[model samples]
Target: MEKSWNNRAWFMVLPVLVLVAFSAVVPLMTVVNYSVQDTFGNNEFFWAGTEWFEELLASDRFWEAMGRNLVFSLVILAIEVPLGIFIALNMPRKGIGVSVCLVLMALPLLVPWNVVGTIWQVFGRVDIGLLGHTLEAIGIDYNYVSDPIDAWITVVLMDVWHWTSLVVLLCYAGLVSIPDAYYQAARIDGASRWAVFRYIQLPKMNRVLLIAVLLRFMDSFMIYTEPFVVTGGGPGNSTTFLSIDLVKMAVGQFDLGPAAAMSLVYFLIILLLSWVFYTVMTNRGVER
Candidate 1:
């Protein structure tokens, strides 16, 4: 028997399609137009071809920012993935403790980005801030404003604090979804704690770990607001990621052509890397 497919559902999706076209596609097209053309103040645009792209590709600033972004992403993934998994493993598996752990883990994720930045900014200050005052009392010179290393540390710590919970929540979800049969089998085998995690829990959590890694990578790479608010691209561009540099070019200097080119490159890099991550992780999941 042939089932009739409902063509009427197409109408339901048409509005969404139109909305996306207006919101995303049109803005993207405008960006593309600006990328390939030079603009003068009086609504005049000149055909510039790929000159801006070539310049951006050759610029040291672009490479420096890219390097910073890469380092930050790698460091974040290194710290967050393992930390999240460990936290997930230790979290209470049932009862009131589970509720308490879940709520605590969720609290940081609920804070707005700007507010997170402001909180950290105040928290890290040397005068009245608990962190700063404590550090100063302990004879540690901690100043994000004057020192590049301090700025980097603050930004990295802030990011970890803000986003690690997301990884924990995802990993926790994966952990909780595993069937009792796996644990029963492990118990019957006399599997040690490490053995249980290795042979049972790790494999079960692989898919969710992949998702957490990708989300964290993309978010860390594209991070702007919190870091910008906290450090303002900082003491000497030490923490200036690609998005920060792009905004500096576009808004700070009002250089549309180069900024557009940089933005396109940034978008392509993210898309390519995300595709690679998805492919590698999905394949590994299938193999497991």
Candidate 2:
């Protein structure tokens, strides 16, 4: 039986569509306009026709920054996903302890990104910072400012501390939503803890896990402020990920053409990788 379609629903969505066009589409158009053109001065633009794109693709500096971004994202996902799941598993499932644990997990996430960076920056200072001072007292060399490895470790650990709570919260929500009948059935069947987690909880949490992965991946890939503030893309470009390099090119060096080209490419890489991840994970979920 055919029913009348509610064409008026379009009216309800028009404001949101206009807002999206204003916020997203307009900036995207500006980027596209700049990507293929060269501006010298007086707002005069000359057509460069992929010149910037070619140079960016050929540049070793661009690729190195991209490699660093990829490595950071991979390391973050490796640590955060499992650690978040484990933490969620151990969290109190009910009562006042649940609220307390949840609040503590929420605290890190509530801190502003730049503030997190600043806190870590001070915390890792070699002179008076607790972490740095403690390490020095223990006879370990720890200086994020001087050592590339130390910078990497500090950034990675900072990210994990700040964002792992997000994954934990999401996984915990998934955990709590599971019906008690499933656990009762598992218990009746004498299912081991590992067996219950593997067969029931993990499968139930797959959707949320996928959500956590995509969010973490996109955030980590586009990370700029935290590392920028902490290391400022140094210890000599050791932690200069793609976003940092883009800012250096655009604002620091004032090279709009190459920066615009790099940004578009950056956007495309993120889109492609995220799509791949979603496809692989969703396919696995469907099969299971």
Candidate 3:
């Protein structure tokens, strides 16, 4: 039997489509316009035809910033994913403790990005902040403002503290959805703790883990606010990731043509990398 198609459903989606076109597509088109053209004051644009792109691709600064971004994302995923899973695995499956644990895990995520950066910025100060003063009292020199290595450590640690809870919550949700029968069956078969986690728990959490990875990757790659507020891409540009560099080019230097070109390339790189991650994970799942 043939089912009748509901053509009227298109009407329901039209408003959303229109909104997206206005909000995203139009602005993207404006960027595209800026990327290929040169403009001076008085709104006059001249054809540059890939000149900006050529310059950006050849620049050492662009490549260095991109490298930093890649390293940061990789480090974030490495630390957050395993830590989140470990924390989730130990959390109470039920009872009053469950709510308490969940709330504590969620607190960091509720803070605004700028506020988190501010908190860390003040917290890491060597003068009066507890962490800084304590480290100084212990005879360890710590300052994010002057030392490049210290600046990097502070930024990385700040990110971990702020975002790891997201991974924990996602993993916890995945774990809670597993039926008790799985655990009961594993026990009946005398499965060891390692066996249960390796065969049952890990497999069940695979989908959420994938989501967590992609989200963390994209967020870390495009990170701006927190690091900007903390380091302002300083300490000899040691922590200036691509996003910061792009902002510097666009807003600080007012180099629209080059900045637009960089932004498009940045967007493409993110899209390609994310696609690769998705493909690899899905294929591995299929194989298993």
Candidate 4:
């Protein structure tokens, strides 16, 4: 006898679809509408075709921001992925210590983004902040507000502090999910520590590592608030990534046409790069 499927289950998903349509799809459509049009004052709009897109494509400023974004994302991924994995590896596997480690790892992730930025902003002040004061007392010139290199370092460090916990939590979850049988087998084989990590733990953690890398990449690329609050995209645009530049165009400069076009392009670049990362990592996972 053939079994009949219940179609009513789809009703449970309808609210989610509606919410997504309102929250994501509608705004996306609005951005697309603005991207191909121009407006003056008083809500007047004119068809501009691809004028803004052409200008953005030809602009050196756009390329420079894109380069900065790429570098930042790569640097963050490099640092956070390994660091998170290392921390996870060292974490207690059971008991009260497990809970302690998890809670500590989770604290930074729980802080609001703007608050993180504000905390760093105040914490890095040369005269008042502990970090800057210590550096100053040590005779090191450490003013992120005045130096481009210092500003970059501060922003990068701030991001790492804020988000590395996410990577750690993901990796830790992956590590814990691994069955004890794998460890027992490795022990029976007299597998070295490095060998066990390389052959067993690494493979098991691959899925979570992929997630960590992608999350770090996307967050770093689109980062605006923390860096904005800390560096204000400055020390002469050294830390001004694409999102900051886009905000400058859209809100600061009030150049809606170019900003809209740039926003659309920015969205596409993120989508394309994320797709590439996902596809490549999934294929590698499948191969292994």
lDDT of each: 0.92, 0.94, 0.93, 0.91
Work out the TM-score per prediction.
Answer: 0.93, 0.91, 0.91, 0.90
- For 1-288, candidate 4 gives per-residue lDDT tens digits of 999899998999999999999999998888888888999879999999999999999999999999999999888888888998999899999899999988899999999999999999989999899998999999999999999988988988898898889988898888888999999999999999999999998988888888888888888889989998998899888988899999999999988989989999999988998999989988987898
lDDT, ranked from best to worst: 2, 3, 1, 4
lDDT of 2 at 202: 97
- Lowest summed-lDDT stretch of 10 residues in model 1? 279-288
In lDDT terms, which candidate is top?
2
Ranking by TM-score: 1, 3, 2, 4
In model 1, the Cα lDDT at residue 50 comes to 97
**Decoy 3 TM-score against native:** 0.91
Query: Which residue pairs come into collision in candidate 1?
Result: none
In the range 57-94, model 3's lDDT, one tens digit per residue, is 99999999999999999988898899999999999999
* lDDT of prediction 1: 0.92
Whole-structure CA lDDT of model 2: 0.94
- What is the Å distance of residue 54 in model 2 from its true position? 0.6
lDDT of 2 by residue, 37-90 (tens): 999868999999989999999999999998999899999999999999999999
